[model samples]
Target: MGSRLNPYLSFRGEARQAMEFYREVFGGTLTISTFGDFGNPDPALADQVMHSQLETARGFTLMGSDTPPGMDLVVGNNITVSLSGDDADDLRGWWDRLSESGVVSVPLEKQMWGDEFGQCVDRFGIGWLVNISQPQS
Candidate 1:
């Protein structure tokens, strides 16, 4: 029950699709709650995801929710979720999954920074930055 910080994405009405796609890519236990599952207060959004959490064995937690009826979804370039570590194999695997069906702004390759770095915008328009640091000599 410790405090945790994770990215919370906001989608207009594609939260379920995006989250499910993430579950497939990250290999995690995904739990999603819908507005109807709550109390049937909003019939229109009853089927839409009220909240979703993906906790992967890789120790990554991604949470997201659909924007309520009145809320505006302004997915700007203000934020980009970043993944960085020394696990080349694992990180590259994630890069392959994330970069799939999306736009790769920077190809994942050995960067001048001495790491495998790249950036991509997922099909849901979520920006991601992955960096696999090389072992120090």
Candidate 2:
């Protein structure tokens, strides 16, 4: 598949509710996973959504996740531009450019989910999330 650009929203505890609302309005398949599904960082957030994906038949893809404690979360800056696909070279090229002169909050590296991922805030203060997915078997 080709690279995708989408918005990834950050919620303090409303990801599940928000994603569900979108699903209701857009009519699509919604998949959600709780923090516990990926080894809950805080017991209190075990039931909080770690990730939620809504893909509509119209080709709209929305992703969101509840922020765990200790993460910097500014209300107005809760949205991130997500770039993801299986093309590592292409993804890395974009990552290099977006992160240059920008603060990389999360260094690009192999994540626990078997993918290379990173998060950064661009020089313009726009947040970016890049994930180089693993090849499907």
Candidate 3:
């Protein structure tokens, strides 16, 4: 699939609830995964949302997750712009440029989810998330 951009919201401990609410308002299928599903054994995090997505009939794509432990969740900084798809080359190039002269919070690399993902704050302080989906075998 080609690339797409959307907003990614971060919640302290309410991602599941919030995403469900958005799904209600926007009318979409919502998929959610908890930390436990990813093998996180910590009881405190096991039930917390690791990720959630709401895709509306109008083509709106909303993603979100509960902030992991140890990450500060300041209200003003809880949202990130997500660029995601299966286009690796284009996504990697954009990741390079977007991270140049900026802070690379998470290096662009293969992640536990079997995809290449990264997070960074642009030079102007806007946050970004790039996820390059790996082709299924």
Better of 1 and 2 by TM-score: 1
TM-score of 3: 0.56
Of the pair 1 and 3, which is ahead by lDDT?
A: 1
Q: Rank the candidates by lDDT, best first.
A: 1, 3, 2
Worst 10 residues of 3 by lDDT: 18-27
lDDT of 1 by residue, 1-137 (tens): 89989999999899999999999888989999998999868778999999999999878999999998788788879889999999888889989999999999999999997988999999999999999999999
Off by over 4 Å in 3: 77-137
Error of 3 at 126 (Å): 16
Please list the Cα RMSD from the true structure of every candidate, rounded to 1 decimal place: 1.1, 12.7, 12.9
Evaluation by TM-score, superior candidate among 1 and 3: 1
Tens digit of per-residue lDDT, candidate 2, span 16-106: 8777765764568999999889986678988999888999886879888988889977765656777888879867877887788779999
TM-score of candidate 1 against the unseen true structure = 0.95
Candidate 1 residue 4 Cα shift, in angstroms, is: 1.2
Candidate 3, residues 47-132: lDDT per residue as tens digits? 99999999987687988899898998776565677788997987787788778877998999999999999998865455779999
Q: Estimate each model's TM-score.
A: 0.95, 0.55, 0.56
Range of the 10 consecutive residues with the lowest summed lDDT in candidate 1: 69-78
> What C-alpha lDDT, on a 0 to 100 scale, does residue 22 get in candidate 2?
56
